[model samples]
Target: MTRPLLDQARIHPAALAQIGSYHTDLIAEVEAAVAANKVVVVGMGLNPFPAKARKILDGQGTPYKYLSYGNYFSQWRPRLALKLWSGWATFPLIFVNGTLIGGATDLQKLIASGEFVRLLG
Candidate 1:
């Protein structure tokens, strides 16, 4: 049998360090929220992916923590930096129990395949 997703999941040390509190207290708060919550969604601007992810979570009767940072015109750089480091190219970087679940498409795939449910428990 294969190992569980959570069991196989790992955050690279270099990538973890790349996060490095870059957004003052905002990123810190996100980190703290992620630590406290089983499901966490990090996004940029008023992105639709986060909403989509939330809709899925809601449909699944699961509670999730949402954290959005930066915007389109002025402050998107920070979120871009987050993407560069985290290897997620889009909004709604979903995480379950501190494991990266990626963006909206990734979330959808996991949910459709029943992996999301398995990971949750």
Candidate 2:
């Protein structure tokens, strides 16, 4: 499952460092959460999906760490860095046991299949 990204070699040497460092702090924050928690949900305000994901976790009695960056009106740049870093296009980027399991729908499927608990173990 390879997603197409611009070849790094095609990027000018002068821009590589800048590109690599863009919103690094935000990425680092999410990384830290993912590392420390069994389940981490990276989301933004004003979005129902993240909340939906949380509700699902709650219903299942699953404890998770959530990292919300910004809403529809603010802090889009930091969220963009998260999207680029995770290769997930939407909010509520869910990580289980340090691996990205995708968003709410994906989480639901995992729960339905009883894989979510397995992942936690």
Q: Each candidate's TM vs. the true structure?
A: 0.73, 0.97
- Candidate 1 clashing pairs, residues 3+ apart or interchain: none
lDDT of 1 by residue, 48-104 (tens): 778888888888889998887866666687776666556667787888988888888
In candidate 1, stretches whose alpha carbon ends up further than 4 angstroms from where it belongs are 1-21
lDDT tens per residue, model 2, 1-121: 5999899999998899899999999898889999999999998999999999999999989999989988999999989999989899999999999999999999999999999889999
How many pairs collide in each candidate, listed in order?
A: 0, 0
Choose the strongest candidate by lDDT: 2
Best by TM-score: 2
Cα TM-score of candidate 1: 0.73
Q: What lDDT would each prediction earn against the true structure?
A: 0.77, 0.94
